[model samples]
Target: MINVNEVVETNEMIEKENLDVRTITLGISLLDCISSDLEQLNKNIYNKIYEAAKDLVATGEQISREFGIPIVNKRISVTPIALIGGAACRTKEDFASIAQTLDKVAKAVGVNFIGGYSALVSKGMTPADKLLIESIPLALSTTDVVCSSINVGSTKTGINMDAVRLMGTIVKETAEATKENDSLGCAKLVVFCNAPDDNPFMAGAFHGVTEADKIINVGVSGPGVVKTALEKVRGESFEILCETIKKTAFKVTRVGQLVAREASERLGVPFGIIDLSLAPTPAIGDSVADILHEIGVEHAGAPGTTAALALLNDQVKKGGVMASSYVGGLSGAFIPVSEDQGMINAVEAGALTLEKLEAMTCVCSVGLDMIAIPGDTRDTTIAGIIADEMAIGMINQKTTAVRLIPVIGKGVGETVEFGGLLGYAPIMPVNQFSCDAFVDRGGRIPAPVHSFKN
Candidate 1:
């Protein structure tokens, strides 16, 4: 029934190339879990995650074994806790308890991480939303599996200057509180301008208000596959390289669509979006940086690399568009510094720097991810990083975010470990120049040139 030549072509195309699926995320909406009583809400949170995610690890494992492709992380993203938990929570203690309960269920079910411990305050913040924001450090530091996010802006609502200001402080506190492990918990958090709700990725993933009440979304990863495809035609035309990536992405996303449909049927939740991101791991063969190398750059920081990435990103979208009708989230490529060994190595080798990373944000899926700065970096500097990245996304009308950790007591070139799947980062320097004027201009940058289109 199948074409033998096509099968062989795909095989020959992928031989010697290391490819693996990144995350098969289960997006569970917590709107139904809200209740007037704190006790009832807690009960609903536990039951929903456990019931929805109980078979997730097993399903992912079975699929990985069936396909001979390694599925790295099994994760879940929920509705922002503040929206669901605020009704019953009157104090930080009540909110902290809810965060603790969510973390417990994630570990119990063996998920790599649980996201959506978040708040969306682009327009304004509610009393309970304010409390949850204040408790982020305590919530994250006390929980192992809980990851948090805050959506401070969007194309429709514009950037919330006040919320952005609060987030800068919260991020700093989160880093300080968890400084023991190189401020690792800060690495698990994200601040976004236009974050999607059905995102099946971590650190920043959360079920959005527009998403289904319950659904299964898959974040398919195959950087190694793409890199492998590039290796086949070392001297091929750039157009040919792009074509190869597009074809490979088509196959990778097809696999993700299959997994999402099957997983949804098994769980009885509606099938959700498939995130086609090149999510790399700490392992040797799973690097996005490697793909850049295969594309002709010795490392990610080489010249012409940004243009190459833009091409790779565009081709991936072209392939993904044909594979699935429903595609969303920050899908394309990820460059998490600590998580990808090649990126970490590049930073340590002086081939990468914070400013260059900022430049890359213009062409990548996420921005300034997993970067570490000196412990003594001023709060204004961190806020400056957030503002710069947010401005890029705001201007381009894309979903870009930052997850930078200011490792307490660590200076440039020093390595800080967050243990397990979080990996580690060598501290990089931030500009010593003051952003006082830029940050103080804080009212709001307003929507950019394109944002004004009629």
Candidate 2:
């Protein structure tokens, strides 16, 4: 059934476009690692993860050479630490100790990052969830290669403003703790609403309790391929543009499908899902903002930008779903400012604002990401920003998240460089107003009536 032209076309997409598999994540359950003894808990945690993911990187590399597909990152995700640690950890330091174990094992296994240093407190914080939240600043600062996330809201649970208020302070503390490193620790932390269980992406990926004991998830990304394909129809109608993108996305996801199955087979792990997220990087032409431009935006934050993004996101799913039977994770286009140079330029040119970016998230995959705020920006203001985005995800019944960095000792008009895939960003200003009273209410924003569909 395989054809020569299909192979040729895929090769073109890979060689010319920046088409690549963004990540191949191994999701491992750690519920078995729970124990009352802190030392034994850390040991179990380390041994379990290292054993599960020991061959992941080597397997990925071997597959890449065989298929000529670039598998960008080999990563891992475990059960939320709070759930298991609740039974073991007596204090915040205990949680950080677990984070250290995660970091150490991640490096040993050659994984770029290990996720699930997380707490799910959508409805409200359990004592363990609160402990993990309190430990995040220290946990992230003290460790490398470990990412953290907290789910503060969900459609079924509404918004947890109590967690929101606390996360604002935690986000600030994380940045402050890593100020010597340009507040890089915040880059590894994400706060979300309706977080997905099967996400292969970092800072948000965690092995949901419902998943299998071991599974492999693949994230495919190709914004450059899409933008390049659009060149054939420079002045074409919207219908033609949509068709072109769908076809390009099809090629992108097909590569991911091939890689995921290959990796799974080689490693003896079951394939979970193919995340069709068009993850961009600092590399030129691999920008989602450029895709918006190719979709006919003068620049990213223009009048018709949101509409253009909505079309791109919808068509990508349409094309991707046809290519893979199982599609999960944040599959829409990502507009990470630091990672996408076009996004950074949009901000510099004033084509993008914090508010405009928020609107774009309504139509895109994940919400406000890699945005830098002024050091003087109030913690309450950060909480207010997260609350607004959470409200969107809650009302729309979709996943949205915030990974904001309050650049310490740096104000607006200044810049901070995180290097590597996490490039650099200008500190965008936030509203001066206060929402202290509203956020300080310390209660849940009840789930919508539509969420009662059960």
Candidate 3:
């Protein structure tokens, strides 16, 4: 089982191809931390997260050093605060106080970000869910490391148009609240359809109520490695090309499997899924768009882009599932505009647009991710966009998320710098056409006929 060539190949991927374990996320459930007393609830939440993740960063670093694999981030995802704070959080501020506690524990444990300042309202919002949803703007604005997400739709439950409409206004408020930082608060917030519980990624990661009390999940990324493999079979037949990608993905995911097992064993936590997403960075060569280009697209949003992405996504799953028994989360290619330089280049070259990106999300892992839009764009328009994406997930029964930054004081044709992993984005124009009447219909979009399978 131990092959010298495979070891050398993995080293090459790491050293030359930007292959790395994207994140080692500790999922800690906050259900037990719930209390009727607000102060006690906050304190209990803080201590639970702190104890669960205190060794996370150090453990990740140790594994990286020992194995010579780069582990990019150590993070945590907790149960939705709405559920945990239901009894104590009477107002939006009360929920925001919970976010502050999350931020404090994240800093104390030394993780990059902590997710699940979230409310799951795929069908309807409860009193607690509504409070947490309303608190997102304040919670994200005040906290440094805490991230928030709202699940507004799911296949089984249908889309909550009310939540979608409110999120549109909430997104705008978040942008205004953090305008000084180029709407960085919005960068940490996401809206999802069919959001996964054990997603080792942010700003969508949350410990689903179904997960164990504590577990370790790892996300691995290697777009450059995939591209490099495809290059070797350039101009080859479709069969050959697909074979190349599958083999390459298998190798890359094996690295994640190793890391996940080691991290779990060391941390004394059960190992969760390995999210083998082709999560690109701002770094050149590490882009899913580049992989698409290697697969025969001139640019990411080109005519055959969606088909190309579907192929890649399918093969990635086919190969990755073989590498580990537990393969979950959004396990495919991520097409975040700001995070991938190739996508950024595509946008600037006018080869990619919001419309094209939305079409692409039908095949990719996530939806309309890390996109910056004009501040003046109406919240109704944003609601309409979210509804459209959610409809895609509902019909297709796949996970799709939106992490849009409506950069305040910015408009189309301008660029906003988010720095680090968020990278920068050229503000893209949105349809000026009004969708107020459509969004004003404040009711749920019933689940599709396929959802009644049982």
Candidate 4:
């Protein structure tokens, strides 16, 4: 199984092709830490995460150094706080206190971010879920590393229009609360339809109630690697092009498999899954859009872009599954606007727009991610957008999420900088058409007829 040529090829991918393990996330369940007493609950949550994740960052660094593979981030995801704090959290402030505790543990352990400040309200909201939902603005504004998500729709359960409407207002409040940071708080809050439990990516990762106590999941990314391989087969037949991508993806996923096994064995935690997603960064040559360009699209949102994405997404899963038995999470291509420079370029070139991006999400890994919209855009408009995306997921039975930032006091044609992994974005315009009457009809959108398959 070992060969010098293979080893050298791997090295080339790492050194020049932007191939790396994106994250090693530790999923720790907080169910056992729940208590009827507020103080005791916070203390228990803090101690549990601290003991479980203290060595995560150091372990990731050790693996990267020894293997000569770059591990970008160490993260932690806990069981949704809404479930863990149900008994003790009486008000929004109580839920926010839990977020503070989570932020404290994340800082102590030195991880980049900690997720699971979330509530699952796909069909209806519990009292605790409502509290957690209402508290997201305060919780995200006050905490540095805590990320939040709300699942407002799912295939099994219909979309909760009430939650969708509430989230629109909450998104606006979150932007206002962090206007000094270019509404960065909204960047950390994702609203999802069919959200996965074991996602290793931030702003959406959370340990589902069904998972083990603690486990290690790894996310791998290699857009440049894929693009480089595709270039070798330029102007080739569709069959040859697809074969090239599958082979390249298999190689990239094997790297993630090795890292996941090593980290799990060393940390004494069970390995969860290998998330072989083509997660791009602000860095050049590391964009999923670039891979699309190599596939024949002039720009990410141009004609045939969705078809190109669907092909890439299918082949990635095909190749990834062959490499690792436990390939899960959002293991495909991510199309975040701010995180991918090519997508930003497409927007500036007028080849991409919010409408085109939404159309693309029907085929990509996630939906409308890291997009900056005008602050004056009505909350009802945001809800309408979320509803449309959620409807896509519910009908198609796939995962779709929205991470939109309504940059306060910013309008279309302006730009806002959200430094680091979240790069700068030009403010995109939204339709001024009124959706108030539509959003005002607050009731659940019943699941599609296909959902009744029993």
List per-prediction Cα lDDT, in the order shown. 0.82, 0.93, 0.94, 0.95
What is candidate 3's lDDT per residue for 1-454, written digit by digit as tens?
Answer: 8799988999999999999999999999999998999999999998898888889999999999999999999999999988999999888899999999999989998999999999999989899999898888899889999999999999999999999999999999999999999999999999999999999999999999999999999999999999999989999999999999999999999999999999999999999999999999999899999999999999999999999999999999999999999999999999999999999999999999999999999999999999999988788899999999999999999999988999989999999999999999999989888989999999999999999988
**Residue 212 of candidate 2: its Cα lDDT?**
95
Off by over 4 Å in 1: 1-16, 440-442
For TM-score, candidate 1 versus 2, the one ahead is 2
Worst 10 residues of 4 by lDDT: 422-431
lDDT agreement of model 3 with the native: 0.94
Sort the candidates on lDDT, descending order. 4, 3, 2, 1
Q: Which predicted model would earn the best lDDT?
A: 4
All candidates: CA RMSD (Å): 2.1, 0.8, 0.6, 0.6
State the lDDT at 386 in candidate 2.
94
Those runs of model 3 whose alpha carbons end farther than 4 Å from true positions after fitting are none
Runs in model 2 lying further than 4 Å from the true structure: none
Tens-place lDDT digits, model 1, residues 81-149: 999997899988889889999999999999999999898876778898889989999998999889999
Instruction: Find the 10 residues in a row with the least total lDDT in model 1.
Output: 9-18
TM-score of 3: 0.99
Backbone collisions counted per model: 1, 0, 0, 0
For residues 1-454, what per-residue lDDT tens digits would candidate 4 score against the true structure? Answer: 9699999999999999999999999999999998999999999999999999999999999999999999999999999999999999998999999999999999999999999999999989999999999999999999999999999999999899999999999999999999988899999999999999999999899999989999999999999999999999999999998899899999999999999999999999999999999999999999999989999999988898999999999899889999999998999999999999999999998999999999999988889999999998788999999999999999999999999999999999999998988888989989898999999999999999999999
Of 1 and 2, which scores higher on lDDT? Answer: 2
